[model samples]
Target: MKTDVEELTPTRVKLTVEVPFDELKPNLDKAYKEISQQVRIKGFRPGKVPAPLIDKYVGRGAVLQEAVNDALPELYGRAVEETEIFVLGQPDVEVTELDDGNQFAFTAEVDIRPKFEVPDYDGLEVVVDDAEVTDEQVDETIGNLRERFASLTTAERPVEDGDFATIDLVARIGGEEIEDASTSGYSYEVGSKSAIEGLDDALVGLSAGEEKTFTGTLVGGERAGEEAEITVTVQSVKVKNLPELDDEFAQLASEFDTIDELRDDVRARLGRQVKLQQLSEARDKALEALLEKIDIPLPDKVVEEEISRRNQQLEQQLQMAGMSKEDYLKDEEKSEEEFDKDVADAARLAVKGGFVLDQLAVQEELGVENEELSEYVVTQAMQMGVQPQQLAEYLTQNNQLPAIVSEVLRSKALNLVVEHVTVKDESGNEIDVDAVQRELNGETGETVAADDTDAADEAGVDEADTAEVDTAEAAEAAEPAEAAADAPAATAETAADEAPAAEPKNEGAKDA
Candidate 1:
């Protein structure tokens, strides 16, 4: 057997195989035996008929067809192995030559892995923002917490801001009642902007038992852009009463016994959340900067595949939302051609980014440890409110476990990259890495005692001084995790290629 491969594209190849009569003889003999058992013969017992006798009885054409049918798969398999083609899917084969007592030849076309070099990734310069937690951020979080614990009480005056009012409403278009246009005793908040435009203003001065009417354009309902007459009758008014920010209130609101303790907890939580956001932003900036510096050529087929998948996802989402593809195009202010063009550009960027990251992972020898993957699975299960075993079962059933594991490994690799990079703030100052991490964990000013206002102020100054360093570290920590989450997992074949064949890199594989 002889095999020849032709380059169709960077990621596609066509293999042509030529088999001589010697290689085809075994399959021919097997085919004769199989066909002999299935046919009826007048003078011979079943499975006892000779090939020459059967040929004379069944005709040469019928025997040759059976022989060819049995030989094709073995020929194809040999062609794949001899050519060393890493096929992505099933091959399309066409027989070019098959004559009696002559060479048998066929051509198989397929998509194969492209050969490419990993780009240089070491000592690449990337700048990240400072992950600092601020007092204002803490206050905002505290305010939100207070609102969550606020109580509502009946009010004896006209409706006002933050006041909930129960009312009967009727809407009419062009002096005619529209379908599903009326509701009784619907509760609404004045100045809370909960109702359609002009409705709040229409109810502002109305007391219980008072009725009023207003007109406005429907902003975004089924009747969007249509002018409608709205009549509302105020039935009752209620106002929210927030508890005073006192020690007793703090004890009631949380596990803390004092207002100071609650304030500290809120400040810590806010700081951590802000730190995480800062880290995320810094990582994105670093990645963008790195991508700008590197010019990578991506396969067109990869981009097209990504775009097709994206469009399918978009269509599914639209359908779930009770919208049509045409409706989405209108909402996006685009034609199908325009949408495709935009998606194609995005797909190209996505493919390039994946290639770059994979190269970096390889160059850096970044990998996920088995323990880390197990921890990730546990964390994800907790977030989803399910048992770890249940989550594992679901992933396995869906054939997604390997993909998930790869994602975890990719994240670990990115984090390794971040750890080695230097980070500077906007002011060219170095930041404290540990403090930044704590902030990202949402524990900013919590360590400072409530009475130690001076220490808190000092910490803030230190945070500013060390902003750059922290930003860099946070970027290093966050980039891989975010990238891993966003990236699509490799298929089984790709994952197999990625995994070390001689020595397993992860504990999961070792266990398996």
Candidate 2:
């Protein structure tokens, strides 16, 4: 076999391949066998038909076509391996020659990774905000803790802010009610603004047994974004009573014996969270700096595909949240043109980042061990709320292990860059990346790690809430991996993330 590569562009190549008849023999034989099993003959069984007889009946051209179709992929792979070119996307293959008994030839035009040298990332500097926990933040955290344990009692007065109200809502368009948008026995918190617009304003100053009509835009359902006249009847109003922040309250709410001790613990927890935010910011800023140091031409096709994918993902999320594109744009304060430009910019950055990291991984000879892959799978499973075995099975069935391995390799490459880079807080204090990593992993003794549910309980937060916060943090930390799982424009990209490990069933709850 002979292979030659022609550079069509810096990011694309055309490969010409020639193979001797012997290399095509195996595929031809296999094709003959397969055709024999499908064709019927008078004296021979299905599997026993001779190649000559079948060829006479089925035609040699058909056999050749079948074999060529089966052989092209392998042939193309061989050509790629021989030329050592990093191809992207699928190749546009055309069989140029088929000299029946002599040789086969074909040409493949495909996009490829542009060859570029990895820039030195040493001494790269990024500035992050100071990890400072303020008194107000601590107070707010403790206040939320108190609210979680607050007792609700029936109130005799009219509805007001912070009051828990039990009400029935009927939504009507042009005086005709929309059943899906109407619900009874609904519990709403006044001033929460979690429901449709104008609900809170109308609910306030209304007493029990009082009904009021207001105009609001529906947030969900098929009639989302449509204006509707909502009639809300308040059935009951309740006042929330928070326990006093004293020794007795501390004992009831947390393991701490005194309010002062509880406050101190809350402050420490806040401090840890602040450090985590700082670290996350630093990682992002460091990546930004690294990207700015390298310039690589991106394949237009890859960037366009990435942009389309991001738009599709965003559309899915907006649909799930019952928001329209216009609503989302309004909320983001961006025009359609601006939103499109942003998506394009983000797509280019993501594509370039993937290319840079992949090259760096190659340059550094980084590899993903089985143990490391297993650990990453487990972490991702936890974040996705699925069992490790189940996620593993899904990945295997989808042939996504290579993408996962690539993701890990890219991560290691980025971590190497981060390690060599200089990160400092606003106050010019040099941050210890290793120490921060340890603390984030729950190795430091200074404060309880984000994953410690027991510590959360001691600090007057529910174990479930703590777990939720930890899961959110983990998800945020794994965004790049998640993006890789969703994207397919890069070497490490996969579309498997679009398929769920398990389909979720709706529990049939009405939206408020």
Write down the TM-score of every candidate.
0.67, 0.84
Assess candidate 1 and give its lDDT: 0.62
Best by TM-score: 2
What TM-score does model 1 achieve against the real structure?
0.67
Query: Candidate 1: misplaced stretches above 4 Å?
Result: 1-3, 17-114, 174-181, 216-227, 308-346, 362-369, 431-512
Per-residue CA lDDT of candidate 1, range 1-512, in tens? 88999998766788888888677788778878887888888888777889888878887678777887788887887776677554544567888888767788889887554555544445655555555667787777666667667666778998887677878987889787755666897767677564578888888888999989898775545776688898989988887666688998888779999989998988765555544555544444445555676765555655667777767777666656655666567766889998888777766655555555555665665755555555555545544656666776676577555456545555544455455555566667654444565543344433322112223333222333221111122223433323333346332112211111122111111100
Instruction: Give RMSD (Å) of candidate 2 vs. truth.
Output: 7.0
In model 1, which range of ten residues has the least summed lDDT? 503-512
lDDT of 2 by residue, 297-336 (tens): 8889888988898788887876676567887787779899
The total number of steric clashes, by the backbone 3 Å criterion, in model 1 comes to 9
Index of the highest-lDDT prediction: 2
